[model samples]
Target: MPPAYPRSPRRNGVHYANAAMTVLLGLGSNLGDRCDNMEKAIEALAGLPGTSLLRWSTVYESNALLAPDSPPMWDKPFLNAAVELSTSLKPLDLLAATQAIEKRLGRVEGERWAPRTIDVDLLAYDDETITTPELVVPHVGVRERAFVLAPLAEIVPSRRLPGTSETVLQLKRRIDDSLPAWMGVVNVTPDSFSDGGRWLKDDKPTTAQLELLDGNYIDIGGESTRPGAVDVDSETEWRRVAPVLEYLDQHFSGRLLRPKISIDTRSPTTAARAIEAGVSIVNDVSGFANRAMIEILAGSRCDLVLMHNLSVPADPSNVLPHDCDPLAVLRSWFGEHLEILERAGIARERVIIDPGIGFGKSAIQSLEIIDRARELMEFDCRVLFGHSRKSYLESMTKVPPSERDPETVAVSANLARRGVEILRVHALDLHRRFWRVYQRTA
Candidate 1:
C-alpha cells in the first residue's frame, strides 16, 4: 500500500485525523522568462517536505489587460497557468512554503501589483472550511478570476468550492460576466505605492488624472504605509488627507461623476474626519478591530474595507509553520471585528473584505492570500483587491518600485476577471486602459 498520508498536525495542540489534502495553486508571469519562472516556482514547491506537485494545466498566453490607447510600452504578454498539489502541510504551512519559493526566485519587495517572473497562490486546501486570524480557505477571489478559474477548471473540472457547491467548471463558465460597477482605489496618502500624492495636490481636482479612472471607487489615504514609511500623528495625517476629501465633496458631490470615496485609514480620528467630509467608504488597513475606528464608522453610513494584517513579526528568514496561516488569523480577526462592528451598529452591507496584500506579510504569504482570495469571500462580503504596485510585485520582478505598472495592470486584470468588485490601482490611466480591455472582452 502507498505510504499512509500524514494527518493534519494539530490545532490548540490537539491532533486531527490524518488526511491527504489536495491544494490547487495558480502561477503566472510576464517579466523575464515567464515559463522559467513557473518552472522555478514548481521546483521550489517540490522541495517542501510533505508536498508534491501532482498536475498542471496548459499555459495560456493572454493579452495584457491594459487599454489599447495606452502607451505600447505598458502592454506586455502574460503566461497564465494553474497546478494541483498533494500536501500534508496544513493550509498556513503550505502558504509559508510558497512564500519561501517566491523569495528564492528573486522576488524583491516594493510597489503593489508590479510584474515578476513567478507568482504562486493557494487556490484551495482540500474541502475543509477554515477561518483563522491569518487565513480563510477557498481563496475569496477564485470565483471571479479567469486566470485562476480558467486554469483551475482545466485541472479540476469536478472540484467544487467547499461552501457554495459551485464547481470550478461552473465558475469558469461565467468568465465573461460583468459586474454592476467597477471598484476604484482611493489613495489617502501623499506617498502610496502606485500614485503617491497624485490626488491631493494643491487641493484641486486633477481633471487630467481623474479622467483616466475606470471605476467609481476613490480610495483615499492620508498616511504612507509603504515599507520604511514614517508613521505620522493624526494631525499631520488630517492635514494631508483633508484637502482631498474636501475637494471631492466640493467638486463631485451629488454629481454623476462622483465615485464612491473610501477613506484608507487605520486611525479612528481619520475615519471620523473623512466620513464627516462626505466620504462614504472606510478602508481600514488595520482589520476593523480598532475599537475606536469601528465605533466611529458604526454610527455612520460608511462602507468598510476590513483587511487582514499580521501584527506579529514576519521575519523573512524564518520558515513559516502550518500554524501561521495569515488567512486563518484574518478570519478569526474578522469574526471578532464583525461582531464588534455589528454591536457598534455598523450594517453588514457596508462592509468589504480585503486580504491586506503585503501588510506585514512575507512575499509568499501575499501570493498565498491572492491565490486564496476566493476563500475569504466565505464571510459573504464584497471582495476588494489592492495589489496595485505592492512589494510582492517588486519582489517577483526584482525591479524598482517605480517601474512596475505593466505587472500591476496584469494582476489587476486577473483579479478583476476573478470577480473582485474593486481594483485599487494607483494609475488612473492604467485603470482606464485595463477597464476598457475588460469591457471589450467581457
Candidate 2:
C-alpha cells in the first residue's frame, strides 16, 4: 500500500450557491462511427438545458465488454471518453438527459454490457454520494474499469471519489499498468543540458512553464546532473527548487488537481526539505550512496529512485569498462544498493531503480541497457529509464535537444514494451499520446 497523506476537504462539483454542481460523465460507443458518435454525444451534452460542458477526455479505444455467456459478435472495440460538466439539473434529471441523448443516438434497451451506439453514465455529481434505484453517484464501475478510469484520470486525476479516500489518479495507478506513469521534467537551472533556463525567470520557476508541464508526477531539479554540469551547494540547490515546490503547494496542494511531487536532487538536505514540503518521491541521481541520505529515506514514506550513476554531474571520461558487461554491472550495483536500502528499512516496492541512461555509459552501453531493460526487472522493483533527449541518441542521429522528441518517443516505445514502469521525459504530451495510441492499437 502507498503511504497516506493528509486530506483536505473534498472538492465538490456542485456549486450550492447557484444550485449548480460539477458533473462527470462517461461516454462510450462500440457501434457506428464511434468517434462521430462521441462528438455528437458531447454536442448533445453541451446542448442540455442549464448545463455547459466543462472539459472532456481523449477518446480511448478499449475492448468491448464481454462474458462467457455473451454472443461472440459483441466483441467490437469501443471508443470511450469521460466528460465534465456544470449544471443546476439534479442528478436524476441529468441522468435522464444523458439517457435521452443515448436513446436519440440509437441506443436501444439492452442487456448489461451489451453493444450499443452510445453509453453515457453519470459518474459523479460534485461530491454528492447518491444511491437510488435509478442512479449511484460515482458509478460503481468507475473503480474497476480501465476504459472509464483512463479518460477520467486524464482530466480530473486529483478529484476524490465521492465517498472513498482514493482519487481518480490513485485508483488508476493501483489497478492499471497498460500505460506507464509520465513524469514531467522541470529543470530549475541555467546550466542543464536540455531546455535549461526555459522554465526559469529571475532564478525561479515561471508559472507559465509549471502550468504547461502540469502532470501527476513532476520531477523538479535544481542542480543539473547532465554531463559536465556545474554543481551548486545544498542551499543554492534548494533555493532554485523551493520556488517550484512553493508554487505547487500554494497553487495546487489540497486541490482537485494536486499532483504528486518528486524532488530530483542528490543532496540529502535538499531531499529532506522537499519531503517536508510534501514531495512523495525523492529521485536521487547519486543512488542514495550517502549514509545521511539513506538515513533520511529510512525514516520517511517517500518513494526513492536509486539511480546508478558513475559519478555525480556525470564524468563523461568515466564510462564503464569495455570488457565488463553493462547489464551485469547494473545488476551488481542494484543488488548492493537494494540490499543497503532493505537494511535501512525501505520497502522494495517503494524503490524504483534507474540504470542511469547516459550518466556513465558509452553509447553502446546505453543501447545495451535499453535493449535489455527487462533483465533489470529481476530485482522485484519498478524500473525507470530517463532517456529523454540525452547524448546517446546522437549516436543514431545528430539532432539538437529540441529536435530529439521523436527519438525519445522511439526509445520510450521500446522501454514501454519491456514493461518499464515510469518514464522521465522532456516531451510529456507527445510521449503520452504516442503511448496511448500504441496501447490502443496493440
Candidate 3:
C-alpha cells in the first residue's frame, strides 16, 4: 500500500495566509449606488487569497471627463477613491483579480471615458516599476488624473510615481486639465467612417490624397468597416490593396518612403501574399490570434500592428460612452498577442499597437482612448491612431459619412498633440493639410 502513505499525519485544521505584498488601487463609481459599488469592490478585493485590505481614502465626487453627446438618462454622479492592499499575490495576478471585480459589478460597456458603475484601476504595485505587455506596474495615468492623484496623495503622501523620479505630491503639482494622445486611425477598410475608399481604385491618387504622405505609415487594410458593410474574401482584399502598394513601390522606390507597408487582414493567405508582394507591415485587425496568420508573419521582415477586437457580437445602437476604460482589457489582449508574435519570431520593435477605435468599442470609449492615447506610449512601440471618421465622431457630430471631414481633422489635430507619429486618416488632402498645420504649430 505504498508504505501506508507514510502514515497520514493528524491535522490541527489550521490555515495560514501567505506573506502580504503591498498594492495600491484606484476605485471609482458613477452608476447605481456609487457607495455600494465601491464597498463591494473593496469586499471583492479582500476576498482574494493572499490579500488584505489596508485602508481606503475618503470618496470624492467629480464630473465625467468627456461627457457624452446624447442627453443624460439620469444624473449620474462620479465617485472616486483609492485603496491600499496587502497581498502575497504577484502583480499580474492581483491586476487580473481587480479586473474580474470590475466586470462583476454591472459595469456595462460604453464609449471610452464614459461613466460607469465601478472602475478599479491599479495605482501602484509596491516600489517596483514593471514594463511588461501585461502590466505597467506604475499605472500609466498616475500623474494625469487629478481624481486619482488627490485621493492617492491623501493616503500615500510619501509614495512616488514609479519610473518618473517624482513623488506623488510632486506629480500632483504638475497635474492639469490636459489629456494625452491615444491611437491613430489607419483604415485599411474601403468604406471606413472617415476617408472611405478614395484610394481603393487608384487613378494616380491626387497629391492632396495618399500621394503626399511622408511615407511614414504602415499601409493598412482593404476591407470596409462602415456600418452594415459586407466582408470581402482574401482575394478581393488583395486585389483592392495591391495597386496601392505597387504604386507606392514604383513612385517611392529606393527612397525608404515609409519604413514599412502594413497589410490589414484577418486571413493568413492575404498576409502571406502581401508579404510576398513587398508589403512591409502586417496590421491584423483580428489581433493576430489566428495561428496561420501568426505563422505567416513570424520571422518575416515586416512590422505588425496588433489591434484589439471583441470576438463578441457588436451592437450599433450602443454608442461609446465617455467613461469606459479599456486599458486593462487592452493590456491583457496585447499580452496574449505579444506572446504569439514572439513565438513567431517577430521582433519587438516591429510591433505597433492600436486599441481598435470602433471595431467593437462604444463611442465614449473611443473618445477616451483618443484622449488618453499617450497612456499607450508606455508600451514603447510606435503608436497608430485609426480614428479618422469612426462612428463615435459621427455620433457626436451627427454628420453623415460623406460630411465628417472637419470633425475628422479636429480629432487628428488632437491626436497629433499627444505625440502620435502616425495618423491614418481617410482623405490624403485632409491628412496633408493637417500635417502642414501640425508642422507649423510644432
* Candidate 1: regions farther than 4 A off: 1-176, 180-191, 194-214, 253-257, 312-326
Q: Candidate 3, residues 327-374: lDDT per residue as tens digits? A: 766777777777777777876556778888877777777887889887
| Poorest stretch of ten by lDDT in candidate 1 | 1-10
Model-by-model lDDT, in order?
Answer: 0.65, 0.79, 0.64
lDDT (tens digit, per residue) of candidate 2 on 23-75: 99898899988877887877777667777666565455567768878888887
Candidate 1, 173-221: lDDT as tens digits: 5567533234555555566665666665664334345553334566766
RMSD of each: 20.3, 9.8, 20.7
Residue 136 deviation, candidate 1, in Å?
Answer: 40
- Residue pairs in collision within model 2: 13-22, 13-126, 14-21, 14-22
Please count the clashing residue pairs in each candidate, in the order shown: 58, 4, 38
Give the range of the ten consecutive residues with the poorest summed lDDT in model 3: 1-10
Q: Report the alpha-carbon TM-score of model 3 versus the true structure.
A: 0.52
User: In model 2, which runs have C-alpha deviations exceeding 4 angstroms?
Assistant: 1-4, 7-111, 114-177, 211-214, 256-258
